[model samples]
Target: MAAWPWKSLARSRQPTDGGDSAAPGKLSLSLSELFVVGTWFGVATGLLELGGTLAAVKLMGRVTYDTLRTNWHYFWMTPLSNLVLFSVSALVLCVATARIPRLRTGRVVFFLYAYLTAWSLVSAIPTLHKTAEVVLAIGLACVTTKFLTKRRSTFLRIAPRAAILGAGLILAIAGVDVYSTNRPVDRGPSVASVAAVGPPNVVLIVLDTVRADSLTPYGAERDTTPNLARLAREGVLFKHARSTAPWTLPSHASLFTGRWPFELSADVGRPLDSAFPTLAEQLADRGYATGGFVANTQNCNAWYGLDRGFDHYEDFYENATVTPIEVLRSSRLGRYVVTSKLAQAVIKRAAAPVDFRYRKTAGMINRDALAWLSDKGDQPFFMFLNYFDVHDPYQPPKEAERRFTKAGGEAQSAANLARDAYDDCLVYLDSQIGRLLAELESRGKLQNTLVIVTSDHGEGFGEHGLAGHGVSLYRSELHIPLMLVHPTRTPAGTVVSEPVSLRDVAPTILDLLDLGTAPTFAGKSLANTWSASAADRDFSEPVLSEVDRADHVPAEVEDAPARRGRMRSITANGRTYILNGDGREELYDLHDDPEESNDLADLADAQEHLHQLRELMEQVTGVQENGE
Candidate 1:
């Protein structure tokens, strides 16, 4: 309840020209002054942004470094937007200040900044009063009033600087992106005599959220993966198929580009950067028909530029016609309370085709993939399936959950039960897999074609206080099931203990297809691990994972925004992981803490292991120790 000093100062005001002032009659808010208000708004927006982000982190438990760096991005992304908003705010405030007004612009702006910053801090902290956020928000209005009254000249200088900094940062990142990406790698490795017109149509099925161990073939309790198990008996089942990332985008990116998650992680929301070649693109160039069906729009052709290689590149699922009520219930308050109406309106407009079902509108995708074969239009085919069933809001139909857990919604409400639902979804996915496999077989293309079954990452249903992923570096998050089913693979029904990452998938697929070798590929081919002798087996390489949002993890409550996805740690050999979060680095031996409950970072015995892992991560990612 700070009193407005600026308003009092203006009460007994006199004109600079010593003329008879008309009692500051009607407050005037012009278009130009409004624009300046917007300029001031740009300066103040960071505080509101900081508040929102802090609240998100408080609820989610962690925030990635890159997202925090988005502040660095807003520094540029919204200049014109700021102009429009500030212009409007300024006009209204000016109009009020002149007449029927008790508000001061400069005072209000200053108070708002203070209120928002304090509120965010209070929200982020677990201790203290619960009303901190409300108090802070109310206090901000006074700050805004003060801010609006500040001399117009200071705003002029600040506005341009803010815009420039953001723009500069954006340009710099773009330049680096251009250099890092742009290699035309996928195009270079051409297949010799690329088969055309039904040379064993290949179906690369990607089961979203499908874990390697969930299948009964892998000794799970439920017959959840009946179809996949049957396929295992008929074809080669790679006991170990690991995805490079714990999330969908990077994992799929690795599959498409044969790169590791760390390398491809930055490519999320962006395409494959046009430098790398995709299997579909490669096949299309060689007169092969390429088509894909996916359940999620994030994995669509448009966002990631995946539709480039196909002639009939159809992603009709963009506008989901049907939606579930469960999703409606799951919406957050913030979704409606987007501080700005424009932002809220934009979100609503874009979300017209939103879906909350276990099965998205994927029937069209299946039909399209199947159609590619029906036409058999004088071309070989490379088909793909992206199943998004296993992701969050794990709704596996009420009946399926009943089969696994005794409790219904109550059980499914728990993390472990959701995992059970995920398993059910996997089972359903397997049935779909069966249908695809049968179609391929009916066409007489099963024997000669290479079948690769794998996941982007595993699900973590409250494995460690964490309900889902993008939070930790635990084995539950990183260790994935990787299987490669080939027509003439000599090592059938064989279990390989060698550690593997999703990075090698690209190179392995290309190798099998008689395409070019992966010179720049950081992963070793699984075929290499299947050496005839199997005597000298150092089959796996040190695997690295990162979560730039340190505080996003439960373990990192303090020390926010350290190293943006720098290097949380690495899993060397297969057992040890040297983890870095919140400025402290720890070592864990999976031999002992498979649950990752124990820390061995200080253990003298782990010195060599830790050194090697750190070195390995540094070499691949180009990230180093703070002092070093």
Candidate 2:
């Protein structure tokens, strides 16, 4: 009868394996005994990996369980999972290697199997690539078993110990990383101390990726934003407004903190740093209930730390529930099988008939906003709402889609299709805006609430070789609509053409509410514009927009020596100067070439303007003029 592997390991009293001892004088383990030790090594390595991650997260602090659950797929619950997987892989490899009668031969095969299995399990995709990796692992295991089966007593005993020691060193390094990560600083006031009384409600609506030119108020050929036009009729519109960055996250960070986008740490996978004070924190400290409802999951999700200081932050994925079994599923071999190309094709074919409706649409967001407003109970509120309908891959409702597309339209160009879809989304968003305003008016909340509508950035449709934002500092991505409506309606329909930065939004909100600006704010308050004499008003401060090319790079290249090339655009004195990372410059006369089709960088007459804008860029970023 065959002896159980563990029992065999226990009965072996002397070092019989044909190798030297792990230490100089210790007895060398036999084949079966070595199997037990190898299994321990694998399990220990796995446990250390998983434990380290958990410890790191705990040390970081301020992370809620819901946030962990929402972001769990990013890690696949790696700690306990690694232990289980490594233990099983070790046991299976040992059993297969045991077929070789020679302890020395079996040891070599076992180590090879272990190495291959571990490498195969490392993955960045849950697709055919994973299947290929697992197949390669199994192939290596089979070959190791077949070719290295000759039984011999002469083998080096030190190899196994060396590998085990290497793993231990790796685990120690991982532990250091966990303990060394910087803890986020606590900045805001405690929720318990917040008073329920002072300041009028402030509503900041960010129209994600919507360019100023797309709106009717900005002279678009299409009536893309009639509701926005209506707001413009009763509010102040700034025609030359610009975003701080050509993307959602950094630009929004600038809006919230009233700082330049360059001042914030930009990492899509992580939350915003807790060191900066947010506008919500400012308001909450002065007795305002702050809430945020955003549709952009990539940058605005609560996991990203943008939810700081808000009394309530609603993200579509926040309520998703993850079971313990679901956490373990990613570590299983069945995951590879289920994610195989054949299985995926079958699933896609089967599910083709089911229409998937987007959960984070403008209507759904407005519904939640209305519900939140109903429950506030007269406490002054600060609300931030972001509508992502105008962003890329724009798919509006069927009615809107049909209206934008021809009734029986033949094949259209990609640009036309994109444009139509974009316009349709704007129209749909406009309707939702109308609904939101009507609700506020009906509830009599409009009379006393200050409303500000703007965008984080704009979208591009293949202009300057870019279809989306974050790649360039073009006007298409920087130019955004900014409209402000006062509660008392003193300066109705005033148009401010001087270039203004999105960073100004926070200071303006505070200024309008009679709240003194926080010392940390870097933006100038536009509240003075209402009362400042025309000559005293300073439009000389350049509106700066920046772009980080690193943010636009694909995830596959993340390990590449982070080549973070940054670009800055300066709009001042009716001219726009875009300083490229490679020291190239593009100058556009905003009045003569709003489309930016003509670049006057080489024009001799424009040299002084270029030099001035270049200096302004350097002053803003604190980087030298030579692309330092």
Candidate 3:
């Protein structure tokens, strides 16, 4: 082979006062050689840390955090970030030693790198206590550095070869990761027996974490969702739509399967199982092409089993494709650096266009969706789009922020600021929705399409002492907007006031399409309420919302009434009865006390209503008073 690329670096030597560089006690290395060695060592250490962490996560099967997921982008980003960091550190060390004659930069830098590498490797062993791991790493690194320094020539001989091997391995792994993640999803065979013809295409858009009351169509004073208001005017809006759960997975599970939350495998740590067929599966089986594009990658991704039946599903960092910033966000070190307070401050500055989080914007999602729609042929398609911008850590675009919220100042409380930002996000989401609708109209697809706009669940902004979803079954978290728009089918401007669960979404879609109800679905078709020609128009029905104690609740408040155990509620006859996890019962007249401040559980007149609701709940959910 041609001479090794690092031959000069390996042979390079430094002169000392004794002049004989080969002297046993006077081992020295040139600044350039030291620079190369230290930089490579740092890069190798980073790669080792990342590889070890990934291997541990895969082998253990317990580290299931979204960040640790094996996204292809992380492979390249983590090692690259480490390389940059280590190279810069090496440069700094080399410059310092050249300037300050007394500083033994080579040994100090090598020792520091060894210690850090050891620490990183040990940290991958999740079973070890952090203190013990650190101590062991330091001890090991000290011994290793001492041994190598004593045999500098031997170490120099091996270092270059080891670094080259490491570089090769990194490239190999990166290539493999890219190939694996980007490979086409094998959609074995088309389930459709015949191509769909006249049935209206279904476009279900879920505005995640959007509460009904916050939208202008739901009586909010602000015009935050003018587009939604227009859609409401052109569609049938369910004024009292409620989600079956207070969070994403379960609520979405209910929406897709037409079943209750307790009946599904979806939970804080678990994903929806195949026990129930999704709406997409039902449509796909009946000659409809299905596609799901979701921005809530944390829970709505394929990892969570939400992409079960879709021929194509797109989520954040999918297909081994990612932007530069997305790659940074996917890496462990880059995640820490990008999410640091200083970096966040810089990103959130008014002049900066950077997003605080690595979420796809609604515009981006819409563009992808529209492109997919363009490719769809004569086969009626069922498309599911989830917009996550309205969820947490609200950072709205500059224009929307200016339009909705007052300038950030000391006068605005934290809650006010958060709510304002949330509204800003809603406005941005609405604008995107408007754009999607306009695109559909321009393409002559709007008239033949059945557009459904709703949410998985609502967000809680200090309502009923709840700040976010999944913590409680309060109205703030359960009440979501539901609207259906179809040119020739659904009656425009029709407002249905009856309480309905999101479970009805699947059944209603099937019912309107004349597909009938699936055997497993527990929800009733909502067509009866909107279709005048139907025999039974009575819309009165009990709506149930359930929530299990979420894992994110702090330990200090684990026993808090709202955060304890499982909570369930049933709304019927304009009254809602809540069975709290702590064995407390609450009853509220939703018509008169929509705020749920007045508890009628102990009232003599309310006992009869509570008893009836308890029976209804037990009959519907098969769970008794003590929450079996």
Task: Kindly give the number of clashing pairs for every candidate.
Answer: 47, 3, 0
**Weakest lDDT window of 10 consecutive positions for candidate 3:** 1-10
RMSD in Å for all candidates: 11.5, 10.2, 7.7
- The per-residue C-alpha lDDT of model 1 at residue 35 equals 45
Q: Go through the candidates in order and give each one's C-alpha lDDT.
A: 0.54, 0.68, 0.75
Query: TM-score of each candidate?
Result: 0.60, 0.70, 0.74
lDDT comparison, 2 vs 3, better candidate: 3
| Ordered list by lDDT, greatest first | 3, 2, 1
Residues 173-259 of candidate 3: C-alpha lDDT, one tens digit per residue: 767876776677453333222332488889999999999999999999788899999999988999999999877888888888898
* Residue range 415-516, candidate 2, lDDT tens digits: 788888889899899999999998777666777788999999997777765666666788888899999996464388788888889988898888888888
Which scores better on TM-score, 2 or 3? Answer: 3
**Evaluated with lDDT, which candidate comes out highest?**
3
Compared with the true structure, what per-residue lDDT tens digits does model 1 show for residues 406-443?
54457346666676667666665666677777766665
- The regions of model 2 sitting more than 4 angstroms off are 1-198, 268-270, 318-339, 342-359, 398-401, 550-564
Over 4 Å off in model 1, which ranges?
1-200, 235-240, 265-269, 299-301, 312-365, 397-402, 405-413, 518-522, 536-540, 549-565, 590-593
